[model samples]
Structure formats: structure tokens, C-alpha cells
Target: MNTEEKGLGSWTEREREELLELGHALFACPELGFQEVKSARILEDFFEKNGISFEKGLSVTGIKASIGKKGGYHIALVADMDALEVRDGENAYPFHSCGHSIQTAVMACVLKRLKERGIAEKTGGQVSFIAAPAEEFIDFETRAKLKEEGKIRYFSGKQDMISKGVFDDVDCVISMHINGDSGGPLFDINSTLAGFMVKKVIFRGKASHSGAAPHLGRNALHGASLAMDGIAYLKDQLPPEAGLKLHPVLTSCGGTVNVIPEQAVLETYIRANTLEYLLEAGEKFDRCVTHCGEALGIETEIINTTGYMPFAQSQEITEVVHRQMLELCREDQIVKNVVSGASGDIGDLGYLIPAVQFGFSGAEGRIHSAVFSVGDEENAYFRTARVAEKTVEAILSDPSLQVKNPDFQKKKEFYLREWLGENRE
Candidate 1:
């Protein structure tokens, strides 16, 4: 590896190449959340090849790999193993448009380096290579099935794992995601992400033959149209800093021109920065659906399956990573940044630990669209590994820095109570 002596550690040339190759493979095979079979197996193979042990079969597609054992202050590192559901020509329905595959590859590379250099032995603690599933919140039906079967109670991969007590032994959680553009200063930390809830609304009515007796049909399409109209009008009355977002996609629109529609399915995500904003905005959206359903004389059912809370980064952990990026990744590599109101499962972890989510961009394409591409050879991967290594060293070197979570007691207790299906009030 090209050594940049910034008082931080470096990676070997072999290490860099291995990381690059991992990125290439992972970027190519974009697996959706919860169904990241290939992605999970590939990472599992890498860990097995490296002689790291883990508690596999945790959440169908999630793997809890660990390094180091016995008594010490343990820290958890997460690499979300799922990709978004986007048809990018090569891979239909699932693709790496979000660049999480690269993020996972780099995380694996970091874990490997930590083991090869015996950093864990010196630190006297543990590190987890948690390949979490269903980070995208795309497959709701399957998640609902998993919950029904007692396989998982929570729909989100991270939330489910947490509900299963996966991080009980962990102190701090650290994870990074690939972002957009290069050379821009990466976000050192987030105050919190915008929180959101996933809602699936199904409008049901009586269908009739369009050409034969169209007037006899109870039009579910009219109800769906009204619901959409409400959403279009709702965009203006949202809070400024709260950052409300409403993305409703028409998943199904009843029937063909020959038939009068009986069912229309609409899936939407309601969001805001604070829980108060989230609840308030969600209420308005809820009212729109109910009122629209009433107006069209169609029964509408809403299902809220997933919720991603906001995350607040620990100044303690970020200062070290931010410093490493600044010194190691060229003179002006690291810059100040804030939360972009994106929703994620890491927020669930942040409620318990002082976590930081940071990374570099993989591709230059527009993020969620079909052209979302992972610029395979971006310097972000190697630089990210180096930063992680540097951060690990910093954590291991300092005794007063501490590895304990800031909100462990309160959050864990609350979640534990929730898991038991008890009232938390």
C-alpha cells in the first residue's frame, strides 16, 4: 500500500488490491435487502477464508461475524448487505444503485486488516462484521411473513436484529455508506436522520366489465386518484427544518381498459426530521387517505410496516474518524457536513450507541434512478479502509476515550420492554 504517514496506520498493496477486487464483485452482484443471499454468502466466504468466526443464520440474510473474544470493551461495526430494488439493465428488480455493495466490501476489507495486523489482540475487545439484511425496506410482505412466523418481529433488518438482542454485548456501533460525488468533504456525523414510516394503502371496490357495464362498477381508481391529489396538495403545509417527504408510488391500478377497476394499491413513505414532525405529517397523510376513501365510497386499508428513526452521531467517535480523514486522505479530504434527512436502520443503532455513518461516493450517477452506477475504482474504497484503520488505532490507543455507549441503559431497557410486548410508558 502507498503509505501516507499522517501518524495513522496504512494498508499493504496486496491489501488495497484485495479490497478493490472485493468492491468489484460486490458492486456487480446487487442483492436486495433481506434476500441478499449471494451478497451474504460472498462476504461469509471472505470471512471464513480469513479465519474469522460469526453467529450466522441470525435474520435469514444477516450475519453476525466477530473478531476477538473474552472480556474487553467491545465495539460493533455494521455493513448493510442489501441493495435497492432497481432494474439497471443487467440485474432486474435488484441492483447496487445505492453503492452499499461497495460499502460492504470495504467494511469486510477493514475487518480483515484488523485481524491480520493483530489489532484486536492489542485492544483486548471485540469487533463485529454485522452483514444486516433488509436495509432498503422494499420487501414488506416477506417481512410481514417473517414476523408472523416468529422469525422476526420487526420488519427492518437492523431493527429485527436488535429486537433479537444481537447487540447486547456491543458497546459502540460504526458503519459507513457510499455517497455521491468525489473530493467533496464527507459528513463527519449527523445530528439525526429524518424519521419515516412506510404505508401501504389498498382501495377495494366491486369490479365490472368496462365495455359491458362500466356504470355498475364501484370505481377504486377514483379513490386512488383522490389519494394522490391529496398528497400533491400536502407538500406545501410541511415544517421547514422538519424536512417532510412524501413518495407515493402506484404499485397497481386495478385493471385494463376492458374492465372497471376494483382494487388499486399505493405505497408511500411519510418522513420528517423529528418524531414529532413524523407523527404530525403522518397524521395529515392518514386523514387524506381516510377522507378520500370515504368520498369514493371505497374501503381503504392502510398498513404501516416499517419505521426508521433518526440517528445522532457521537462527537467522541467522529472527532477521531474526521481527524484521520483530514490528515490521511490528502490535505482537504474531510469537510464538515450535516444530516440530509435520509431514513435508515442505523438510526435504530444510534438510539443505543454513539454511532457514526460515513463514507465516500462509489459512482457519479443520480442515486435512486436506473442509471445509478458504482464508479468501481473510486479512491473512496481504499481511503475509507485507511480511515477505518486509523480510527481503530485511535480507539485502541486511547484509554480515556472509552468504548461504552452513551445511551445504552435507557434505549436497551426501552427496546427490551418493547420486545416483550409490554407497555413502555
Candidate 2:
């Protein structure tokens, strides 16, 4: 169908090609959180060529640009720039299994197309484009090192950017995530999502010869195993409605067969739908790990870190995006009130602004897995860009559009002090 018949905004054939080409380029060369040097350079080139003035390296390769009047209400469009550490569909090194490459390309295309079409100049508000890094909660060691160096204060990209005063002037925010399979619907509006906290557990014990003086050794591996068992038993107390999810992995165990293991490490994420339930479950979980270490006579240290907040979308924003989505897809192809147990740093943005993250179906396999890939490039690139672009246009045109601030959106320092033990380094 032609642009007039389709009811969605128009984009040139060249624009479509650029978006798809960029998407594929990003997919071919995936990088982990806070390490997206080449990925950031690609976007920087795009912005420079298109005359979008941007500041580079906000949180290690993050980019931001603004268009429209300075004093007007600001509308922000954000895209995560980092990819996953999972093996690709070919079972190679790192890949874009989480579809962040597509997401980033779509956001860039949306902003570029809007600028080319003169929508920002006509609108009364300022529009900002933020290419954020480290959305995925992986690479904890790298994030910790950055934190210790006083380079960053948080693990996730959005939180780090917020701390750096990136979104201070922004009012409304929009983001798109790639969902699994283009089967049931082309688009979905997120109704809600769970938030989580990170925990790193270390068990220390004395090491001794396994055969000669086994009685003198204190086995830390045994202590970690007992803690895992206790955590399994504690699952019985988890209420189903709280949407609690606790998955712990033993990252390090014994070193060799001849010596009793002196150190063991465990890492986990505690997720829940509400802060009250999350804290309740978190405290209980801490007790389980600590008591297990005490029972085994091993020293234990549990470090708590803040995670994304529970996602709550503005009803008005959802209504606006839903209307724009209907123009792109048929009524049957639109899904509403979708809830997921998964967590995202976008939820942290939602707490501060009237933010909404919608999903588009273009991939086939399970998310965050090796087999996940872009099954339909057309839907993933051009079509998805159309929806996002139109939504931004609609919101920018409305002068009365305003977001209601909620009480639960706490300051960034609260999280740093309460969870991360931060007080200006």
C-alpha cells in the first residue's frame, strides 16, 4: 500500500534501506554493556551526517541530541545501544539475541525521519534522542569496576544516565522493544512489569589437603551448596500473586580436586511486582544465605545493589500510542494490557516520567537465547519505525500533553545510599 492509503507517515525508499542496513550492521557486530565502542561510533556517524548535534560518551559510548525550542516541554526518545553476551544463532561469541540492535536502529530512524519531515520545528516542544548503554543486567564485574573508579554510579544504562542528569529536562519518554514471533500481533502495549535487585554472595573458608588433613579444612563449596538448598526450601513461602522470581547461580566453586575449596560465589536477582513484596522476599532470602554460611562455619558477605523499579505506564501515553499503532496494524493485530514477569531498566525511567515501552513482533526464537534472531526485517525495521515516529509526532503536536508525577519515583541518591552503600564515593 502507498503511504496515503496506509495512513501511517511516509518514509523514502532510501530511508528504509538505511535503517535496515544499519540494523544488520549492528546485528553483525554485537558488543556487551558499557563496551559498545564500535556501535556508538556507527550512531555517531549517523547523527553527524544527518546534522544532529550530539554529545558522545555520556556513560561510556552513550549519545544524546536535542531538537526544537529549548524552553518548551521536552520529549525524549531513548534507545538502548548495547547487545547481549549470549552466543549467536551460529553459536559464536556475542550476538544481538535480545534484538537491541533493531531497537537502536529503529529509534535512530524515527528521530532522523522526524527531523527530515520538519515535525520537530512545527511542534511546540523540544525533542531529545538518547542512545543509552548497558540496558541488559550483565557484565556486573565491569560495572563494579566502573563504579569503584567513580566513573559511573549504577549498573543499568538508564539509571546511570539519570544520575548524570541526562533526563532532567525531559518530560515524556518513548521506547520500543522487540518481542518474540510475528504470529499473534504486530504490537503490544506494556501494562506492567516486575523490578528486581542484584545480590552477590561470597563464602570464605580455610583450605587444606583433601587426602592428608581433610579434617583441618573448612569447605566453602559445601557451605554454598547448603545455601542453595536453603533457598530452594524458602521458595515454599513465596506467594504466587507477588510475582516473585528468584534464580541463583553458583558462579564459582572448588578450585581443584586435591584441596578443599576455600572460596565460593553465588549471584542472583530477586524480582517482584511491588517494592513491598520485593523487600519482604529480599530480606528472607538474605537470611537464608547468611544462616547457611553460619551453619557451615564459613564467613559470608552479601552485597546488595539497586535494580530497575516496577514499570507503570501513563494511561494517557498508552492511549496515544495505541491510537497510533492502530493506524499501522489492523484492529486484530493490536494487543492491550500485556503484563510480563521480566524486568527492564526502562522501568526505572517510567518511575520518573510518563514513559511507555511498547513491543513489536519481528523475531522468532526465545529472547536472550542463541536462536533468537530477526525473522522479518521489514516489520523489524521500517514498519516499527513508522509506528514510533507517528507516536512521537502525535505527542509533540499536543500542547496540553502533560505527565502526572507519582509519589513512588524516588530520587537516585536514595537508591545509591540504601542499596549500593554510596555517599559520594
Candidate 3:
């Protein structure tokens, strides 16, 4: 790709430097989910300096800045603003192992460039830059406390935004993530993602002295262990195409070693490729856990929470983006139609309107691991932003480009009622 042909010739050196500086600033202080105080402030300051007015505190820390008028074909460019907790030796700290800092920075750069070039004025359609919070599902304890205080109703940030009518005016969504696996290609388009449901189980039994009267007590820990074994055995029966993944962790199993465990808590996620298959696998999983605890003469209680819907990329939008990718990368350097088991809240937003999350290669090391770092800042931060900006311009310039827009309210109600069992008025 030559300089002019690369489509990056228009990007000024100052803009390029600003992109790297913003990425590095975000990477320096990685904050989790809704607690991204410093991270949010940095992006907010950037928006202020650029003269972009934004609404903050949507999902506690999520931000939205809109350009152009609201009535036309509205589009949103989403950037997740949360990081994972990585452990080093004996201590654990928040880090951008998932490269969300790159997403935030690139989107910020795209928004700034679009505003500077007055692209939105040409299209007469709105372009919104959304800094979404709590894409990562970890830190449940803190989230639960927030829930008790009525700060948030859903664990995922996108769900909360949906319930709060954040995307009510938005027509579609375009987002990107940094692909840690650089072996694939520079860009990946139209990849599918799995959806998952959060599961929590509790087993209760009578406590007794282990040394004196072990036989009189029903061990809850034994029940949990048996339930995990049952789940492991059921895995073989599940179809491979379903992509069933169940990995339960024992969060609590008694307090002392001398007494028989009277309570055990297990938490996991049931993930699958489609909604029907996800529910089917969830039913089987529940039965396995419930029966296993019953067999051990322990009382079992299970709680279910909606995680995310399966992500099916919009083919029409993807084709448009593919043309943009071909200009910056070789034909062979773009991967298409790959399926992945990883889940993201973007899937939830896809249920209401057309959404596509393209992947760009620039990072190395395993994602969600401590060693993950950006190896190619040019591709991760600069090139990816160019493709995103170009895609937006293409979509906005061609009013003929269209995708199926589902009934926003009906779908939102169905998601909240059928999937989440909540009937919000």
C-alpha cells in the first residue's frame, strides 16, 4: 500500500502524534468497568479541547458525543472503556490487556478528524462517538453493590444503555477491537461471536464436626464437586457447533477445615453460538447441577442472569467496510467470516439494529493476560482509525446503502422480558 493509496495521506502528523499520545495516556491508567474515573476524564478532556459537546454519566461512566443533525441516517462509533484485572506475581492490578485503550484512542481520533474535516456536514447525518463502560464482565461483587444502590440494573454497559434509551435515536453501530493474534491478518470482517448467560448455584447442607461426626453432616462442597463433574461429563454430549463452554469456579466452600462444609457457591457462564442453542445448553446444564446436588442430599438454588446475545454481523455493512480494507491492505491480508467463542455486549446492541465489530491486528501476547501489549502502534492506532473513518464516510455518502432495522422498542422489550425476566414499564 503506497502512501496515497494507503488512504492515510490526508492524516496530518499532529493527528498521528495525538493518536499515539491518547493511546499511551489511556494505557497508563487502566480502570475497570464503571470505575473508570481517570480514563473517562481523559477522554472527556479530549472532547472538550476538540470542541465536541458530550453527555456523560449515562452508564455511570459512559460518554456520548454527537456530530451533525439528529434526523438523518444516524450512526454510532462505539469504543469500550474498560480493562481487565491482571495479576503480577502476588499482586493484581487493572491493565489494558484487552487493548481497549487502543479502541478508545482510535475512536477519539476518528471523531476528531471527522469534526475537523466537516465530514458530518457533507452527509447530513449524525455520527456519535460512544465511550461505553463495563464491557468486561468481571468484578461482579462491585457491580452487585451498585445494583443494590440502584446505580445500574444490568451488568453489561450496553444493556444499561439500551434500557436507558441511549440508542433509541441511533440507526446502527460500528466498532472495532484489537486482535491479539497477529498471525491471522491485518483486518478481519464479518466474524460471528458467541452469546452467554451467567449462572450462579448454591448448595446448602448441615454442618458438623469433621473429626468427631463427619457421617452426620451432608457436605455441600461434595455436592458442588459432584455437580462440576456432572457438567464435565455432559460436555461430551453437546454438539460441537453449539460451542458450549462451561467453566465453573468455586467462589465459596465453607470457612474452616475442621468442620463439614455446609455451603458452597459456584458461578459460571453457558455460552453458545445461537439463542436457541444457548437456551438448550443452559437447560441441560441446570439439570446436571440440580440433580448432582440432589443426589448428594443437599439443597440447591440456581440464579440466572442474561449475559449477551449472539453477534451476527451485518453483511451489507461488512461488504462496505471490506472495500475500505482492500484499499489499505492486500487482498490476502483480510480475513472474512470467522467464528469465535468469545462474547461481548456488542452482541446485545446488534439485536436492535445492524452492527459490525471488525478486528485489526497490531497487538501481541494473549488477550486478557498480563503480557498483552501493542506491538504495532501504526496498525493498531493509526491504520485502524483510517479504515473506520473511511467506512463511516462511505456509509454516510451513499444514502442508498441500507440494512434491516428491527423495531427498537419491541426488541428491547423482548430482550428485557424474555431473556432477562424483567418487565420494565
TM-score of each: 0.79, 0.86, 0.90
Error of 3 at 314 (Å): 1.3
lDDT of 2 by residue, 375-396 (tens): 8776777667877788788877
Give the range of the ten consecutive residues with the poorest summed lDDT in model 1: 416-425
Ranked by TM-score, the better of candidates 1 and 3 is 3
Q: Model 1 residue 69 lDDT?
A: 71
> Model 1 over residues 322-363: C-alpha lDDT tens digits?
777776555454444565677788877887777888756546
lDDT tens digits, residue span 318-397, model 3: 98889888878798998878889889999988878899899998788888999998887778887789888998899899
The local lDDT score (0 to 100) that residue 414 gets in candidate 2 is 64
Q: Per TM-score, what order, best first? A: 3, 2, 1
By lDDT, who's the top model here?
3
The top-ranked prediction according to TM-score is 3
**Backbone collision tally, model 1:** 5
| C-alpha local distance difference test of each model | 0.75, 0.82, 0.88
lDDT of 1: 0.75
User: Each candidate: RMSD to true structure?
Assistant: 4.6, 3.4, 2.7
Q: Alpha-carbon error at 305 in model 1, in Å?
A: 2.1
How well does candidate 2 match the true structure in TM-score terms?
A: 0.86
* TM-score winner, 2 or 3: 3
